[model samples]
Target: MEFLDLQLVHALKTDGRAPLRRIASVLGVSDQMVARRYARLRETAGLRVVGRLNPRPVGQTVWALRLQCVPSAALGLARALARREDTRWVKLAAGGTEVVCHLAVRGERERDALLMGRIPASRAVTSVTAHRLLRLFKGGPTGWDGIASVLTPEQRDALAPAYPPPDARAQPVRLTDLDHLLLTALARDGRTTHAALAAEARCHESTVRRRIAHLRGAGALFFVLDIDERSLGGPSATALWLSVRPARLAAAGAELARHPEVAYAAATTGRTNLLATVLCRDDEQLYDYLAERIGALPGVDTVETAPIVRTLKRTGSVARDHDPADGAPRR
Candidate 1:
């Protein structure tokens, strides 16, 4: 990616649905130039702006599942998991023997049926563990600093959307059939026009716009960038499980969230409460990140690193069920 391309990406990270003219103004470029770069990125970098639902506010419990599968079954198992609507971040790690993913379920019965029943009965999986996310310090709507810092403060302010603080007294919003249809279209392309969404949802364009605003205002929807990791730094990333003292866990997670390399960080119910995804250019950079940055964090006891072999899914449903050849974009 070129410098201008990165800036455009950063601008989109700030506001995925911002018009090309707005991004152009922020980047100090012509609208045509921004449009050209964006089209080129979509063609080459697998750039996708996804409007994802926030499961937390919708009575869903999110769990990080790690399945130690037979070496031959890792990719197949990962692809299968990625096809499921309830899964996200489906990845192969631990030298291609472990399949890791995030799963969301509405209740204990749904959670147990998969976690305790079907998954445990699979012969290809040697073992599995589930970590319920207790609190999310970062990830989801939070843009990673690595790709988010290219724009100047003024540029960012120009692109940033104004969101009101959450209301504790507000009632939880339920997902309607129209909401599902609109989200399905937006997940494929977050910048999908209101007319397109209205066509699919069988509603007026104004209704589509108002419903989208309502969902976002209720803290039920936000946008995320689904760009190729190789465009940022490298083809792979490492997942870290840090055992931090409970007294300083919040501080440590917040610190990790600020690191440019960290794409996601959260506190979980597990032996190692702090989990983060760090991106580095190479093995040496990964080593330095573990040794210098993570090692210096206060109250961090032990850190476990699992270099991802491949990530099959990030934010949306898998576009294809088959694995890609090496060096190809996984999107």
Candidate 2:
């Protein structure tokens, strides 16, 4: 990707909803050039742009799982785990001895059962360790330095705006303890039936339905979408850290939140004041995103990124345990 390409990515990273004309003006290029480059990046590289939701807001729990496996079996084990619908991101690290996976789930018990019961049964997996994300200090794609320099004062003023319009508000509803339990259950399995949730939550089936409706109305529950990156030909995912002036935090975060490639963006406390995550198609796209898109945002002084070498766990779920049905342990 060219220097200008990085600028476009940064602009998109800040605001996926940014108009092409705005991007062109910022880069001192025509809208057609920007559009052409973006198209090429998407079509040739299989890069995708999507909005990511915060798991916690929707009652989904995130966790990281670390797996120890035989060196040769690591790839096979990762492949099998990745195929499961519950699995999100998987990483191979520690010289192939460790496999980390991010998982999303509903409640602590079910998540525990999955880890202790299901994964240990697999012959490929030798051991597993899980950690819940207590608080998200940072997440997202790296910023672009090249574009930061390219952005002129007027361009920055034009690009950086106040908050985008708020999303539609869902009406709130009262929830009982059973309601919380049911919501937690469905958070783990979006497709779970009312009967299943009722059984787990220890409530009547009709109560489960009512509580679900109330939770949905309150915007406390949401459907989980399982995306197949391989099917889309996208490469692995990465998280980025950005340090920006405190005075500019809101503007920077608001802009970063709009990028389609960015799945999560938030202001945080630390050396890197801002965090964002991005999904790409390959190394080329990742490079382009970091160099062009992320580097260009206003008020960003520096960007640091670490590729998720492995997802130990995500959304509070385990990777390996014995299969409850078969009584076979997952390796």
- Give per-residue CA lDDT, model 1, range 1-331, as digits (tens): 6889999888888878899998998788999999999999887778879998787777788899889999987877888888888897898899999999999899999999999998898888999878999878778767475744688898988988775423323357799888989988998899999998888877899999898899888988888878876777553589888899999998998898888888889899989899899888788889888999999898998998899978888887563323346543354
lDDT of 2: 0.59
Error of 2 at 225 (Å): 17
Query: How many steric clashes does model 1 contain?
Result: 0
Residue 54 accuracy (lDDT) in model 1: 80
Q: Model 2 — which ten-residue stretch has the worst lDDT? A: 140-149
Best by lDDT: 1
